[model samples]
Target: MAIITVMVFILIGIFELTPLIKKGDIKGFAINLALLLCSCTVLTLKSLQISVPSPLKPIENLIKAIIE
Candidate 1:
């Protein structure tokens, strides 16, 4: 499943990101690549059953600490 996701993301980058590079839009290229990488990492982690802690946990703890 992770392999499948990677291949799919590769195809997507070839198609979608090529235009950004060809047009010399470095900012657009960087943004798109970041988004692609983040999604791919998350999906790959999910498929591998690796536990990723919730992003909001720290915020929740901070709020609780503040209230107390």
Candidate 2:
């Protein structure tokens, strides 16, 4: 199931990247690829039941401390 999900993401990424590659948009393609990879990694991890630590926790804590 996780494999299937990752494969689907790969297909979606390929579909999305085709236009940028054809148009010679290097910067846009790079940014899009980076974002797509990051999202796919997160989704794959989640599908595999992996627990990812959130970066926002410290910020939230800081905000709470300031409020108090």
Which one wins on lDDT? 1
Cα lDDT tens digits for candidate 1, 19-58: 9999999999999999999989988898888887889999
Q: How would you encode candidate 2's per-residue C-alpha lDDT over 1-68 as one tens digit per residue?
A: 67988899789878988899999998999999899888888878888999877979999999999999
Q: In angstroms, how far off is 2's CA in candidate 2?
A: 2.0
Which 10 successive residues of model 2 have the least lDDT summed?
Answer: 1-10
Task: Tell me the whole-model lDDT of each prediction, alpha carbons only.
Answer: 0.94, 0.88
lDDT of 2: 0.88
Candidate 2 C-alpha error for residue 65, in Å: 1.6
- The segments of candidate 2 whose C-alpha lies over 4 angstroms from its true place after superposition are none
Estimate candidate 1's RMSD in Å: 1.2
Q: Score every model by TM-score.
A: 0.86, 0.86
Model 1 clashing-pair count: 0
Report, for all candidates in order, the number of backbone clashes. 0, 0
